[model samples]
Target: MINWYPGHMAKAKEKLKENLKVVDVVIELLDARIPFSSRNPKFDSLIGDKKKVIVLNKMDLADKKITDIWVKRLSEEAPTVAINSLNGQRINLMISKVKNLMSDKLNQLKRQGRRKKPIRLMIIGVPNVGKSQLINQLCEYGSVKTGNKPGVTRGQQWIKMRKDLELLDTPGILWPRIDDEEISFKLAATGAVKEELYDSELVGYKLLKVLKDIISDTLEEQFDLSQVNNDTLELMEDIGRRRGCLMSGGKIDRERTGNIILNEFKSGKLGRISLEISSN
Candidate 1:
């Protein structure tokens, strides 16, 4: 039921298709915490036959065991590496993977005695998946605009990482429609979809429900709860009361409480958590 496809995203997808004709390798960035939901399903067609290196950005905020499972599973499809773009963790490994994917093509060009060309890479992903931060780390400087919210990068621009590396940074684009409600909530919970498009209280409630199933102990400890109540609304209300999100009549302010839970989860204050895990 949650759907948000801005007009710009449509145009961005077209631009991405056009730009793909010139790039040699595609860098598909994904959130380490929500890898499955963060992936734009349209990519399988959009990037057909192109060499790809999947970089699981924000590994620092994801559960290591789950992330490792994802890395292994996704590697069968394409070269993948888990990295924290903010601090450049495992960035070298990603670079190595990218180079390895292009090795055959580069060698073929060399055999023809042609001039060497910089490897052109197009970085694509959903918004707020750390694409810009990953570029900044690659360039070792702030080469592109970045923010914690979705839809920050709106246009395409080329950034030269080195003499042999050129990157095309594009706006994060989502599919025209998201039919799966659970996927929609996961996207919202992980900050992929814009906050203005969904109800925060509903997302908070859904997120609490998921945490209760997978990380009840950590959630309880973080919020100082004696025990996690099975009723999600009651759990949220308890959190609201503990965090002092009270109204004039001592009622729990649902909106403020929801935002508190969401912000804490996004900021990793709830501890390293992964909402999605590899089925394998």
Candidate 2:
């Protein structure tokens, strides 16, 4: 169900490669909740040996313990900082980490008497991972348009933020296909993938199943169900009945119920959840 839509990917890769030569560091944004699923696999190969700071954006929505585990794992590879891009939380930490990571390069520039130039940074991430929102936080002002859905920034555009920083804004890109079915569902569940690419009912049902295993008690508490059910669809029906997502003839509107469940999960109304855990 993953749609490649390679035109943007190819263009992004080309533009990224061309710009990579000029940038001092790359701000690789990952959804704190789905660090594994939201990450573009090609990003590693595409950004080989480049100085990168992994900013785990939207940390506010993620489970703290799981996010801490992710930070520990990812920091082994690159400087990882957890942040909430929407309200500029921990943004300064990200800025400082970027500066710390680029210290050597900055020193080299100082040796050459060329500290006049800004540290060029390009923010890259999966769709809806808050690249634009992160940019706004960094600049402390709105510079790029942002949306909850994918592919808002359609072309390559550069924005000058801090006197010492310049950002290249590009449309969010995902791999044409995903190797793991679970990862695909996780991406679809987290709104990382386009709605049209996957069946919401299927993904929502899968989400409920996962929640049933991990946080069934929370579900029972949230939906006020007398008892949790093993059947995912039955649980959805129960939720629909509670949420009043009904159709004509008083039938459970599975579609709307599914959306409510997903939206609740996404909005953290259900609970702070982490879909992918560290293999370690």
Candidate 3:
């Protein structure tokens, strides 16, 4: 599945490059389940020589054990924090980490006898990874509308986070090309792309299969789906039957089955599951 970047994301990419010059630090948000896939490909180079704080967002929806693995893995590359963008949870820790990364920069300015300036940080992430949600949490008292749909943010804007820290929130950017099948599968599985990439039914079935393999009894417990002796398709059919998605001839309605499964997973009804696990 080769994913093409949308026109709107192209403008964000250009703006991201231009805004990099004014940023002293970068805060990149990655989906906790698929950290590598959630990252913007151009991030490292775009942030060159600047301090970075990689935030693994949506932690509540990911496997806690896998999240720990990613936290350790990413910490080796840069300072990493696992946070739930909702409820303003773990955001203060993120603020503290960013302040630490820019400590030297702040001291450098002081050495030059320059007045202290607000810590300038650029926030970047792929669409739907919770960058805007995190920003809204950090600036909850301020006027900002947060949504589940991607691309709600249209242009660049700066918001104050703390006494001496200013955040430049940019529109989320997806890369111009998606060349890896494994990555595409992971992204589609995780709801990163719009629902157009794959059949919703297929995606939902895939989610159930994945859940059966990893969490075992998770699907059965959540959806009241019974454990069946049959194969994956049969199990999906059972789910379809339970949900009353049946064709006129009495066949399971696959399309509705798919939508139900995918929606349930997205809404966290399938439980706190992570699609990807660490190799190490």
* Global Cα RMSD, each model: 1.6, 1.8, 1.9
Error of 1 at 181 (Å): 0.6
Q: Give me the overall lDDT of model 2.
A: 0.84
User: In candidate 1, what are the lDDT values of residues 15-39, reduced to their tens digit?
Assistant: 9999999999999999999898889
Q: List the residue pairs that clash in candidate 3.
A: 201-258
For residues 1-280, could you state the per-residue lDDT of candidate 2 as single tens digits?
Answer: 5655658777887788788887778989998988988888888887888899998888888999999999999999999999998898988888899889778877888899974677788898988889888887767356777788788777787787874788877777788778788888888888886777777777888899889989989999999999899988899999999999888999998877878888899898888899888742
Sorting all predicted structures by TM-score, with the top scorer first, yields 1, 2, 3
Question: Which segments of model 2 are wrong by more than 4 Å?
Answer: 140-142, 248-250
lDDT by residue for model 3 (36-154), tens: 88877788887787788999998998889999999998899899999999887888898889889888878999999999999898888888888777877777357566777767776
The candidate scoring highest on TM-score is 1
Judging by lDDT against the true structure, name the best candidate: 1
Ranking by lDDT: 1, 2, 3
**All candidates' TM-scores?**
0.95, 0.93, 0.93
- Whole-model lDDT, model 3: 0.81
Candidate with more favorable, higher lDDT: 1 or 3: 1
